[model samples]
Target: MTADGGPDGAEPETNTGVLLFLPYRALENRVFAALAEAGFDDFTPAQARVLQRIGPHGTRLTDLAEQAQVTKQTAGFLVDQLEKAGYVRRVPDPTDRRARLVCGAEKAWAAKEVADGVVAQVEKEWAEHLGKRRMRQLREALTSLREITDPWA
Candidate 1:
């Protein structure tokens, strides 16, 4: 190890993937804070993640699990909690009788509205720091990367 604690003189920087998660974690924290302020304090972070992946129309449990990168059992457990809290409901899938679709309930829609506002506020703050053009470019870059990184997206 050198003086900088690396093999050579150079210091190591944070991994880009971990760095990317920092902002996401911050946004998640902000969203939780906003949700708590709105009196929606029953939801947990894990449940919120599953909830966020649910399509506007509805989504299968397997898809939710896949998108959230969690196991089917874990996703089902989270969905059960959300259902009990009135945030989501399981409905019969029109296409497949054996499958059930998780649909956002009225409370979920209301919470989504709040979460969306918080996301917009955070994005505005990030844009101010990164400059509007750079922020747009950043979003475009990330979106493009999703094609390779996110199998469900």
Candidate 2:
């Protein structure tokens, strides 16, 4: 669809940015669907948030909880489920054996690698339509919006 054409041929600028945001939500849905089709559908969005925080370096459950904005108990419960699903594991922290580090399992790691490629391909396709400069500007605007909306950090 042409950006200038609204839902029914009217100009979208007459309204707010709802038209722009609707397409963005649709894009997110498509990306999520792609990941699910690739076998990463077992986790909830909250679980995905937790897993994203763990990453390659790994992170403490408490830290993940803080970053995910969930209580420690809630984070622990999510981690437990993820562990049982073979997406994550808790290993002893070398610096502090008393604490455990949350890490991605083999399946989760592979999914992340695949998802990275999928996202890059999606962005490249979008860049061809929106231009690289607009895409970069969109990224900056989204980052700023997140910071503004999420007061807790």
Candidate 3:
């Protein structure tokens, strides 16, 4: 073992970016599983990423693309697929006559309910593992990090 008690020659586990991604990916897997169990097997991971970024009322295509870290064309393509799947619909933006807003539909709401339940279950598991105090601290730390890490937030 090295001086830090890690394996000899092993790299230090200081990559907070990667550390953050692990839980995110795990949560995503659970969400996907929940969606599949709900018979919403038509959705793709990419589409889900886009869908998650959409605001409750509606969101612009450009904003979705920005938040999803995808090109506008890619966002539009995913939106089209979501539209066809009956999970989302594009309505004319009231503020901008030329622009459209993507809004969640009935199917999306149903899937969201399932996803929310899964998230709550996973969070409860995490809380049990970390204990309530540590879990709260973890959330607070992550929320503080968001000030620096999240552009949209």
Candidate 4:
């Protein structure tokens, strides 16, 4: 180990957590850039975190909060902002009259389209770099890891 924690003096980021976070951060940045380019730049990362968990039909505030690992109040606040921005709407939960579900608006779906395209493109680039076999293996490994890493999974 040298002064930089490696013989080559590379920054010390060999840990599993950092390695996993790097590509995720890159994908996130690319998605946000594409979203901004597509005229959907009013949201923040924290808000997007909560928004990503909303189901196809809808999701309860409590559920969103739990899935996003945030407090109900925080989720509510983020949802409020999303509502103001026309990205989401609250509706009766049908099964429970007293409960409401957060449903994605058309604007939110539009943003999702842009994000999905970027994600697909990024995956293609990653696959090109890593080769199909290695990339498929990588994805399989990550998906297997998600069983332990993701609470909802």
Candidate 5:
């Protein structure tokens, strides 16, 4: 078990948790945990990726695929999975019937609220620990680190 009570009482004996932990990784795990608690068990990571790319106004399937960095067929499969889960729908574009817009379902929006609450709680805890100025500094530092670590990003 680690110091965060991840399992048994045994704790990791160093500062490795903060040093090695990636914030994005932690957020992803938290989001999935919140989604499970919210009774959204049907959606997969791939499906979620597609839905996220769709955004609030909806997006073309091709754009979603590009944003997801996946092949068009793979994005279509992900969209299909999301549609099957009742979390998203594909509708004909009013401007262009030939293209479809992937939109989030009402239930998906509700589940998103739950996920947002979880993230807010996590953020609150982190802010309390780091304080406003320190948190801002950390964000700036991380931004710089990201530029250095992933120039293409």
Candidate 6:
């Protein structure tokens, strides 16, 4: 209805930002559902967001808070919950004795395996629907976009 052809000049479906988020939301839903079914049902999305940022060698609490875009206290609370659930453990950082690193436990890894399978299944379905070429292009575009949007990426 606008001169540019957007409804009230607001881009909805055709908005690049909205388009980019749709697939991610869908994938996240699938992963969480799969995780629940696999008996790793104690995790909240907030806790998982922090858990996902833990590096292989473990990561500092401050870093996880920064990467997950949460306050330090909030991150600490989530990490404490994760620790109680047996999904993560805190250990002294090798590089810094005064600091601690959060590391994923075997339980977390098992849940991640389930989540990974779900993601792979979703990606395959997307490739089938979008065609492999479009899927690849979409991935590449997102990765390129991360260079700007994601500080850690």
C-alpha positional error of residue 84 in candidate 2 after TM-score superposition, expressed in Å: 0.4
Please provide the root mean square deviation of candidate 5 (C-alpha atoms, Å): 6.5
Question: For candidate 4, what's the RMSD?
Answer: 3.2
Candidate 4 wrongly placed segments (more than 4 Å): 1-13
lDDT of 4: 0.92
lDDT of 3 by residue, 1-153 (tens): 223335565566656666788898998899899899889999899999999878899999999999999999999999999999999999999999989999999889889999999999999999999999999999999899899989988
lDDT by residue for model 5 (66-104), tens: 878889999998888888888888889999978999898
TM-score for candidate 3? 0.91
Position 7, candidate 3: lDDT: 52
Please provide, for model 6 over 57-132, each residue's C-alpha lDDT reduced to its tens digit, 9 standing for 90 to 100: 8899999999999999999999999999999999998889889999999998888889889999999999999999
Q: Which stretches of candidate 2 lie over 4 Å from their true place?
A: 1-24, 140-153
Whole-model Cα lDDT per candidate? 0.92, 0.82, 0.91, 0.92, 0.82, 0.89
Off by over 4 Å in 3: 1-11
For every model shown, the clashing-pair count is 0, 0, 0, 0, 0, 0
Model 1, backbone clash pairs (residues 3+ apart or across chains), number: 0
Q: TM-scores of all models?
A: 0.91, 0.73, 0.91, 0.91, 0.75, 0.90
User: In model 2, where is the ten-residue run with the lowest total lDDT?
Assistant: 11-20
